[model samples]
Target: MNRHHHKPRLVNLLDDFAFGGVSRGLGIFSSQIVADAADCSVVAVRPDALIAPRLDADIIVVHFPPNWRRIAFLLSLRVRNPQARIMHVEHSYTRAWEALKVEQKGRFRLMLRIALRLVDQVVCVSCGQADWLREVAQLPWHKVDVIYPHAENPGLCTLPLPDFSCERPLVIGAYGRFHEQKGLENLIGAHRAGALPGTELVIGGFGPMEDELRQLAGNSPDIRFAGKIDDVAGFLRGCDLVAVPSRWEAYGQVACEAREAGRPILVAPVDGLPEQVGSAGLVIDFTNPDALARAFATLDNQRLGVMARAARRSAQDCGLDRQREWARLIRRLVPRQARPIGVPVTA
Candidate 1:
């Protein structure tokens, strides 16, 4: 078993703030895989991008401007390290295409298509995302693989479920970037409909909609905007239930994370979120605020406990070990010649 032969040089390309669940999950999984079997590095498109501290130090970090120069930088690096395998952890094809259109010149779209073909594999965070890559970006299905990201190591939390002490205030918490796709407006409407006797809504994150959301929550003592907390697990631990009323989702990583943390999740029956939540959480209609309000009203401590237990059990199937296995399967699908040669085998 040649140790040096086992190491595959790998590069991951991320566009911006790696704090989101998808980015964080990919970073954790990639770091662990690289630490155990391969040599890996991460490249942030923006120079001053904020990244998770959990990323392995051995995974070299690089930054480049999100212009034509970024592509040029990647090309130069590829030339210098011809053996390296490049994996684009695509968060959003829409953003990628937008970047290509704005930054590059001279058949930029064509160049992007060609550049995508050059890579051994393009791993999409969800099946919807993979489809988007193929349909919108014109990437071939054979080149795309769906690998739903996993939660960070769940062992960090030690808090036992709080004794069903609160009067079950019909509490609901939504976590994600404050964007149009999140359906925060719908959630607010649902909250206003007198969903429960004592309803409280807590939203966590920061975005352009922050001011609008704040204004909407005005004088509503029942609603609180926590504004981008560092410890999501802590918040999850305290919440009775979680809601993800997304209009569209490539993959709802927060739903998966909440489930892993043993919290019942209520998500819009859209995209890959329902698949991720499985039977553990309620998947309701995204368009109907009244339906969402009714769903929240039905949530109780006993029901939450049952759902949480099921969620935790189901989450085991989507953990880091499952991700590692998927990575191995993807690697096996790659051409043997393209893989690192003479690698030592280990379980």
Candidate 2:
């Protein structure tokens, strides 16, 4: 039980537990935040593929059906745990909108509006997302708080550092969902223009743009696609540097994760990425392929080491402790309330 303050019982609402950076960060924070007085529960909209086995015994897991039954399930939860503070962690607009769309006509939207209104606090992982909740979803900005995701140094314990000391092939790694927003196509163009010798580009992760990116990589021996990696830290550890060429990012979790893994990162100055990168990594204008290529050419082992150290230092600032502080603030602002039995917290 967290003893720093009177920890409030919290129910975290998540869409699913997929193997993404956002999910991983939420899992880590949830587990650590409730270490003292706070009792925690996780309600997944659907069955979770990646379960956090380290969750405390007091933490309950409830999986609801994908359809309309979710409302009834949540209603029952409120009846059972009237004192629990509901924390809806919005990860995607698609999932949140879909859930909101379930009610007939505009009533669903109204219900969703009312539902979030009941929450003690709504947490959005990125500022862009917080904006979306306010503008697109019509959630009040005052109720929605931006809690940037955090990552811990994996250290040399689980993942061993690869021998990147040689003046060998310069490995440039780009990781993320293979979607249009990732800007992988632009990165490919930059790599082609740069045409730097002894440079190898490896893109990791799977998404809709797999075929497009694969074709763009061509049959060139210098470029390779490693596909989706289960152990991101290990993959980053083996690479010389990481790149985030996102067109628009709510929060570039890849950049933060790479930093936490003690790897140098090059990111497009998009959304919260620049704020996330700070002075820790290189920020490039992704619109210009020639400039991106030139930036890639300049990256050497010595430069990588300096950036890696800075990245680690930056990551430390957004660790589990920082998240707990946010949690404390949320608790203080909202306090606790009593609700009717069997009535949904949102309703």
Candidate 3:
């Protein structure tokens, strides 16, 4: 940076600033994390999909996953920003996802390995994800650092916990895109098996699987769809518990939000979810037909109250120092820029 603009330039390169956790993570990083330490900004690489001649930055944080087609682009990015420290934050692709979705595992791994070589450092969003990268992908552990999806959602954090003393039918809420990856089929199946008696399932959000999910519900009075939710905290507050049955989630933002809202969560032990859930909520193998219902069958007002308090405490624990992590990482990786102390004194 020039003497006039002395702060280090921390720029985020995003494939799409459209939606989803990856985009939201960039928003959080820009507003909360990097703003305090550097001159922060974002470049949406997907909108116009142009590779500029020069991207002026001292530290470039990448927010998108790499692919075979993007390999050339990544090489170009590295070549262009030779002076900057480029860090690729891998926000997608766990081994579980590759197992379920990718047909050619060997080829895919090669692509990832190639892409990773172009960046100076690799950042994973969760510890579990980082572990998988080191173990399965055979990436060097020295180059990997995990930074979980975190933010200050004051609305959810400040919300009053549900009054668990009320003897009412349990309300379990599900939110997010209606995708096969989310595995709502497992949750719907658990409810339909009559395993979840006297329980209500409220789902929100929209996607291609909307019709399939609704059809699976099949006129069940207990299962309802609230459509696309604008007020997430309000939606979370209405429920006694939140369920995330994702088959493969690298890191679950929904689970985090539920905890922040002072509501306990039920998550499948998939990818990084168990790590995020910690002791604050229930971790069941949603793939097991009877597992979810069995957990739900045991919940009483007393246990729910205990879990709610734990959820609040867990949320508090998560919010600690996430804002400062980026600054620390920049300091660790990027060379310090000399700042002007003042005009030199002429003797």
Candidate 4:
């Protein structure tokens, strides 16, 4: 059996596939590079021990969050697939989120350590997240790799940046799940205080907090709720400014999409958001009620136009070269094909 003649089999194990960046990134991976590089498939699996049996592949990439109770499931996976290269993609869990949510710090840290040992490598979506793994989780730099989220929009570069040269109310757009983690309330708080006097704030998405958020808006003509937008580009195209006021984000997908459309983004200084802004937009204390208002107050037509152009340039610089990065990662992880286990079937 000549190993040089065979390509490695790669399986992406997804546990939580709700509406967010983790699920979206997997969608991109399926189409972008890995599928072309090797025999690749995306499979959804539960964290339960019974379902966590060794996946049939040369490489198994885990796209799931860690749990203390699932330590047995993880260990069993490694034990069963002793010959396979295992990797975990950390799409969530940052230093700020842990501080805000996890009360038992020591126990949580121990759980994370146990989980990390089960996999050969970690795929961090943002540089900031990798930094957190090193600074807070004490994970070695050698064990992790940073691959930023990227999307391919053909006409984004040609689309003109949002024009404020005409006399119209500033169209400020925010889109994502209406969850507390998203920090939509911070944006609403600013709009409610009459801080953004002439701006039209359009928020697109639905979640558990819909009714509550609607009530907070309270019969205001300027604030509108756009339920479940399928066209993210169309949404960004209509806006003068985009807001990503996440309390904790592994990487801001909307921030990336907004940049692709040449729209200036306003992101909170939390987790990977400031890293996403990267001089293309503004990074501020956007989560604070007072600061949120002041943040929007400083933005004018001239400043926004400058940022919009910068956003387009930033997106151009990033491009779709990440496809190559993914291919390289897979080839580096498993240099020689050990075996071909199974072909991917949709579940």
Best prediction by lDDT: 3
Could you tell which candidate, 1 or 2, scores higher by TM-score?
A: 1
Candidate 2, 1-347: lDDT as tens digits: 32243344444546657766555665554555634435555655444333222222222223222223344444554455544444566554432334433446355455556556545557676775676556645776667777776645355223433345775887778878898878988888777666445778888889998999888878878888887777777678677668888777767778877777666778877566777666566888766976766766776667766777777777764676556765575456545423323333331
Worst 10 residues of 1 by lDDT: 56-65
What is the alpha-carbon lDDT of model 3 when measured against the actual structure?
0.81
lDDT of 4 by residue, 6-93 (tens): 5777888887777666766665566646667777888877656443665667788888778876777777777777767899988878
Candidate 4 residue-pair clash tally: 0
Of 1 and 3, which scores higher on TM-score? 3
Task: Give candidate 2 regions above 4 Å deviation.
Answer: 1-7, 29-32, 46-85, 93-120, 128-142, 151-165, 195-198, 297-302, 333-347
> Per-residue lDDT of 81-189 in model 1, one digit per residue for the tens?
4444445556554432343334543365565566565455576767756765676458877777777766665442343543445665656778788888788877776
Deviation in angstroms for 248 in model 2?
3.1
Every model's Cα RMSD, please? 6.7, 7.3, 4.1, 3.2
**Model 4 regions lying over 4 Å from their true place:** 1-4, 151-158, 317-319, 338-347
Q: All candidates' lDDT scores?
A: 0.62, 0.62, 0.81, 0.80
lDDT of 3 at 306: 88
Position 250, candidate 2: lDDT: 62
